[model samples]
Target: MGRRGDYKHFLPLQTRWADNDIYGHVNNVAYYGYFDTVVNEFLISQQVLDIHNGPVIGLVVETGCKYFAPLEFPQKLEGALRVAHIGNSSVRYELAIFKAGDDAPAAEGHFIHVYVDRDARKPVPLPQQFRKVLETILV
Candidate 1:
């Protein structure tokens, strides 16, 4: 497990039946989906991300995961999100998936997103407002 204070925000996630594979556990790929969903929803809720005409967009550049326990469908999850690092045009997001109410995480991972221009899709500096929003979630 990672440091208990690594994350600053928590989002509840309800696992769906399709999230589990034939072996009856959540597929590994589904964890990444949870990560993305939590982060994006946070941004949207904060009005930092405007998918329709946002000048700046985040593009995933890297991702990784490590499972410490198994998670099955119908289980409720609490995904914790935090900013691990912030660079010129990129941010690394650390995620921890916990079965609801569990102090220790079932899995932990991180993914990097490089902000870019929506039209040209070229790397751009992190906008001031976006940075501020992210700062609130930084551990």
Candidate 2:
């Protein structure tokens, strides 16, 4: 339901041939991949996430999506991202996918990530640096 302006950041995405199903559209599950890619791409690009060695890591605890229109392969896409909520140990990321240059979202959803200690896997307060980065995209 989000418009392009609702998001603070956008990442370009390409639909691969394998992403399409026999029905001639991108599968429902592929939308989730787009959502995940945009969020992590932003975090990594901002240097806040060290996936291979960071002591604090985020684990997805919840996620959802709603499709409004079909997306087909061989199309360019723009994945939009924003923060809906930030808590002591969790953050809710809202995301949407649109055909490149389109303002209306083809799909939209949210996912909650609970930051945890990499080894203990116990919930922990989000790192100050990470939290600050997320704040920049808060909505």
Candidate 3:
């Protein structure tokens, strides 16, 4: 598929000193952290997840990444997040890491979260409000 519009939500991420590698570029692994941060921040802001005491929690079932360019430390990143898919208790979160003011993405990836009951750890259907919030971000 072709590229779509930017995500409805954005989370700014500050690159740390330790994030850079010997090559002077941000390590690829750190992108995963950025992805997690952006999505979770959205969930929290939307009040869709309660990390400490919620009855439901999402467990990542799949993930992937694709790098388009290198990133360096001391640079602030704008992580654009959107929902690509929503299934039974599962959602695919698509992320694009962009340098401030740039239209193209430095990195793009997606992760699938299967929601489960906090206690039983069994798959559960997403709540109506939760799905509603995610739907606004669907790409």
- Most accurate candidate by TM-score: 2
Local accuracy of candidate 1 as per-residue lDDT tens digits, 1-139: 7744667988999999999999999999999999999889899999989989899999999999999999998999999999978899999999999999888899999999999999999999988888999999886
Put down candidate 3 lDDT per residue, 31-64, tens digits, no spaces.
Answer: 9999999999999999999999999999998999
Sort order, lDDT high to low: 2, 1, 3
The better-scoring model by TM-score among 1 and 3 is: 1
Q: Summing lDDT over every window of 10 consecutive residues in candidate 1, give the lowest-scoring window.
A: 1-10
lDDT of 2: 0.95
Instruction: Give the per-residue Cα lDDT of candidate 2 at 14.
Output: 99
- Tell me model 3's lDDT, rounded to 2 decimals: 0.90
For 18-65, candidate 2 gives per-residue lDDT tens digits of: 999999999999999999999999999999999999999899999999
**What lDDT is obtained when candidate 1 is compared to the true structure?**
0.91
Model 3, backbone clash pairs (residues 3+ apart or across chains), number: 0
- State in Å the error of residue 37, model 3: 0.4
Candidate 2 residues lying further than 4 Å off, grouped into runs, are none
